[model samples]
Target: MKVIQVMFDTLKRNALNAYEASDIQTPNFDRLQQKTVQFNQFFAGSLPCMPARRDMQTGRYNFLHRGWGPMEPFDDSMPELLKQNGIYTHLVTDHKHYWRDGGATYHPRYSSYELIRGQEGDSWKAKVDKDMNIDGLDNIPDEFKQRKIGSIAQDLYNREHMPKEEDHMLYRTVEAGMEFLRENKDADNWFLQIECFDPHEPFFVPEKYLNMYGVSQEEFNGWLMYSHDDYTSEKADQLKNFYKALVTMCDAYLGKVLDFMDEHNMWEDTMLIVNTDHGLLLGEHDWWGKNIMPVYNEIANIPFFIWYPDLGIQNESRNQLAQNIDVPATILEFFDIEIPEFMKGKSLRKVVESPGEVNHEAILFGYFGSNMNVADQEYIYMRAPMPGKEDYLYEYTLSPMRMNRRFTPEELQGAELDNSFAFTKGVSTLKMQTSDFMGKNYQRFGNKLFNYKEDPAQKSPLTDAEKEFEMIEKLKRLMEENEAPETLYTYYGLDQIHSVEDVRKEHEVLDREQEAVTEEITFVNYHVKDGYLTLINALKDKTKAQAMKQHVQETKAAVTEDDIRNWIKDNVDKEEQARLFYQLDMTLRVD
Candidate 1:
């Protein structure tokens, strides 16, 4: 038995010809529709890049407990499980994230893997081009410069080496995948994952592809930015064309896989699962990218196709509520391996065979710390944190690394041991508080409800009381099933806001107290014994400092503001210490 999973980073569903893509030329996808079971409503369980990949690898949702991070030590990785069952799992391609700090734990799960570099902000293939202005932040987008201010100058540096279409990462990644297939055509008992980080950002493709869509080579920049400061109707149209051209390029390479399958007659036995990590926004719903925005269909409803020889369900589309996590369970079941009890995903065998049977009433999906979204057949509910309730947020993880690096001392300072989640295999995890520190968007958009039947575009939010209640209940039930941390219930206001009256009261309280409620958070080192004197000297009221020093001396304790901060650190919980010291320091400045 064999399975080949072609995973793309941000392949939009609506950009595929099979998924009612009108303007985009995705004939390869259309051909795939004839050879595979096209999933019409497949959604992404976790969001962005690494979180979605974690869901695919672990067969469970990662966003519920943690944001972007490495795979947990206890994660039942799909490829590793397959290998344990006498199945050889091999990974190939240029998804540069697999080598990142957060996604580093995933590629190793496979029996053998090949990593091709130079995608997105991947620091690969350095070449000092004296002709190009490499040092300035002028070329970099503001999202890469300010709020998420950084430089993607590496991408341009990497591009300097790839001068031709064939030299591009996309081309090389697909070619490597095809080479793997060529080598393993006669071999069995192997699962191959060809992951490509293309059709994602910059929409960087060959000029030939752009020419097909009447776009010039110079017209495309990153095309997708997190900010809407430059969005216009004309810009949207231009960006859409660029995106379509890249998707077409993706289709061109995808056809190669189809051609290989057809040439070797591998479709008779081999299973092919073509899926994306998640979809890109492509200026839909007046948004440019996926971050800090609502997880609308453009970003959550991804492209998924499967062709299992035994199922014989080709050339048909299913309305099943499949998600990224389901890919692992489907592959396991195909090889007759038992799906782990820890996995929340169900096999798609029944989804394709059982018509008119709904597999999920509502599936939860979102970026962690952003929105907790629930989508059923009819509507989607995006629940944000209540005004004051957004103050508390945490990420429970065995792996303390963020998307690109290890957690700093400040982030790890307040971490506590938590042993509540059932999926953690009785192992305790570090409970780290975010506490308004992370640059990632949390509760940027308010609560929203969209009925698909009325607003397919999700432009207008609905105001149905009954529907909102039902969706909220379903979200709560799903969250409970997922064994979400108890703090999340409070942070999301699920434990508090039940009715309109509850909402009204919270809003009133928020309105009155929000003006005066400014909380400061930080960590203090007790080794700074002079902190006591520093605090005392900085105080406006010398008499009060003197009185406090005398009291501290009598009690055999420290007297400075820093000393008090350290004292709070040694006595009170770290969570409360920061706030207490902040208040004390604020008071010390008073005359």
Candidate 2:
């Protein structure tokens, strides 16, 4: 029972030929289509990157509980469970987020892991260049508002170390994955994951893959802003070419992976999975990137293909609605492991083998503190928050952090221990406040019901009275089933009484005695780094920079201009430090 899971980041559904985008070339995906069961209605869970990965690993949604953070102490990671059950799991990935503060707890679940660095602002390489001016670059984090088309400072610095096509991280990622399979392909009862961060923003492909989509190399901008733009249609087409070329590169690497499987003659007994976290909008819906817009068909609907050895279904497409959260259950069931009762996802082995078997009646997908979307076989409903609500979202997690760095002390100042979730292992987690609010953006794009069966493009908003009521009921039912926060029920104005029992009454774990920890040990490595990031961003303001530098010097901690992310990983990755900064941090700036 060998399983090889191949994951990609920001892979647009239309970029692959199997998903019926005639323009982009994906011969390897087309090849996989013949050897696997293509799921036409597969959707994404959570969002962006780490949230989706958490959902895939835990077989449950995380967006309702937390925004973005590491796997909790109570999380039931599939790979960890598999490893405990005598199955070996290995991870080889170039997704740089796995090493970040929010994603720090993921890769260790595998028996062993390998990471290929220098992808999308990873703090990998270090050097000082006199002429390395970043004023011309538009993709820096500080310039995200008007970010146009340029690589960030860190990515450019990392690129200096990679002058050849084979030097790229994606190439190295694939090569290392093959190296693993080369050593252990014959071994059974092992799971190998080969994940790549490609075709995402900063679409910096090797020169070989560019200019193949009829857009010349000179016209290719390797970056796209994460906001809506009025770029000329000509520039949009050029950007599309850039993305297509990157996808083609991904396809090429995928073909190499498939070639490895073919050359080894392992398909007869091995299971192959092709999946993505979620799709991105490439010049569609007047948007260029993701995370800030509605989770439309272009983004929520993802491309997934699975090849099961015993039940080999080839060149066939299934319309049953499934989401990425089901991957954990599918893999667990394949290994004959018991799916945890708390796992809400269904095992797709049955769904794939039998056409009449329904995977789910409805599934919810979106980010935390935003519009909650519901998609069934018939309709797609983007449920809006209340019109005048301030969102007032709280992230429930054992570790409080964001995608990259730790949350500020102010954000965690109001945290309270909560035990409302069913899968938290009876551990009360920190219920912290966040600044993610919903108003104009979330509500405006929502309340939109698209009859996907009649209007696949989602251009026309359907106004069916009966279907709207049905979907509203469906949303409430699914939300309650998922153990949604009480605020979420109010956000959608679905706070009607139902048969669901009171949570505190049903689960009285809170009344139990708290575990006591009284040991006190001297900590050696407790130095806090200075506010160098504040210093760097305030360079133009000499007065502010001087004040920040003085404050930093007063703190007497290690300071460096080397890497902000490295500094964060070293300084802010701890909960106590994040909370300490509330009192220690300077209020010299708007902060």
Candidate 3:
């Protein structure tokens, strides 16, 4: 069987006319919808670029264990499995992340692959345009100037070389894919993945597409300018139009693929799957981009369509709730290969053949160290870490490479072998603390529950206590099924269903365990000694001691001179409260 999977990056569900009404035209997507089974409730299992791709390949979620990392050594990659089954797997993509430190392991799994450069911040060009000045570009903070300027400069160089619309990276990528299809159309036992990085960021499309939308050259910038500053409505509209123009260009590429299939009549034999990694946030919910905000429907719910030739299903819409994880399992089923026991995804063949079939109860998705979210088609629940509990998370992976750099010495200092999950194939691997790499807001969105039926935009957070409790319990059960780490449960303050520590001990590094215990004791002893020092320091500062006494009697305001003054005036018996206040002052300082 031959299959072609068209993976588009950051393609929103509402971009096509078949999905939702928009000023942007996607006639090709609409045309493909007629010949394919469109999925109505497809969500992204993991987030951003690489993590989502990992889920697509492994048929399991990646965010639960790691964020933005490469394929693990133990990953049951779909392409590799297909190769082992005597099927040729080829990949064509402009997603440059595949060449980075963390993504280097994925493309090698394929039988053959082609990477098209000059997408986003990809450093494909060296010439720095010293004279080009974009409007409002200087408003970017100085701290971000180097990276942003480098991207802008590289993009300027890339655009300079492409004089024609056909010379664009998206067009070239599609052309390469078409060439591959034309050459291998009659070949047996081959799968082709035509991955496009268009319509992602920097939404740079050809002038012809911009002309179709009546967007002038000067009005369009080749940068998305993912700034934290609030955007005016007019500016947001302009940015949206730019993205729409790029989508139109991407639609034309899809049309070219359809044209190839029609001309060759390949539809009778080839299975075609069209889907996006995840949706992009275009100023929705005040989010300028993805990864740093809540995984709302605008960003999490994605577009997915499939055409199975043997099944002979066409122009139908399926509402069976699916995710990116299902793609790998579906591919494995198409090739008649045995799905691995570690896979957590269900094959979409069942759901496609029978739309009424329920494939999943709840879909879990999130970025690492962010809110852990679950959705049941009607309601979406986001469980955030308790305040200051974000540190209680760890990343267990054999591969310690980061996005663009190797793990630092500090990051690996406490790393040790661990086999806390059943899917690890009885192999102990490096378990590193997430706090070593994940900084504050590592893509954080606080706890929230939303009923999409009422608030499709997810603007209003629901306060139903009973509903929240039910969702929390469901999330905990799912996490347990996924074999999530103990720290994950502790981080969210969820009741542990099983002892993850026992699982760790089953494959323990005895020396590391003892060292961990020793470190805990040392930490406690240091704190005790620090408390005495703080008390001595408090005794030496009578002004501070008096202020602390006054602070205890005042209204509950954080430490401030005004609050202390108010307490001093209100207290008539200062001597009686002095000792208690001194201890309180020492405790506050020590903590």
TM-score of each: 0.82, 0.81, 0.82
- Candidate 2 residue spans exceeding 4 A from truth: 129-151, 215-221, 437-440, 496-591
| Residue lDDT tens for model 3, 162-254 | 778777899889998999988998888999999999889887778888888777556756566553444788778788888888899889999
Q: State candidate 2's TM-score.
A: 0.81
Q: How much lDDT does each candidate structure score?
A: 0.75, 0.75, 0.77
The predicted structure with the larger lDDT, 2 or 3, is 3
lDDT of 2: 0.75
lDDT of 1 by residue, 366-465 (tens): 9888789999988999987654565467788888887788889888997899999889999999998775432223432557889875788887888666
Reference-based TM-score, model 1:
0.82
Clashing pairs in 3: none
Candidate 1 clashing pairs, residues 3+ apart or interchain: 144-150, 145-149, 146-149, 532-560, 535-561
Preferred candidate (TM-score higher): 2 or 3: 3
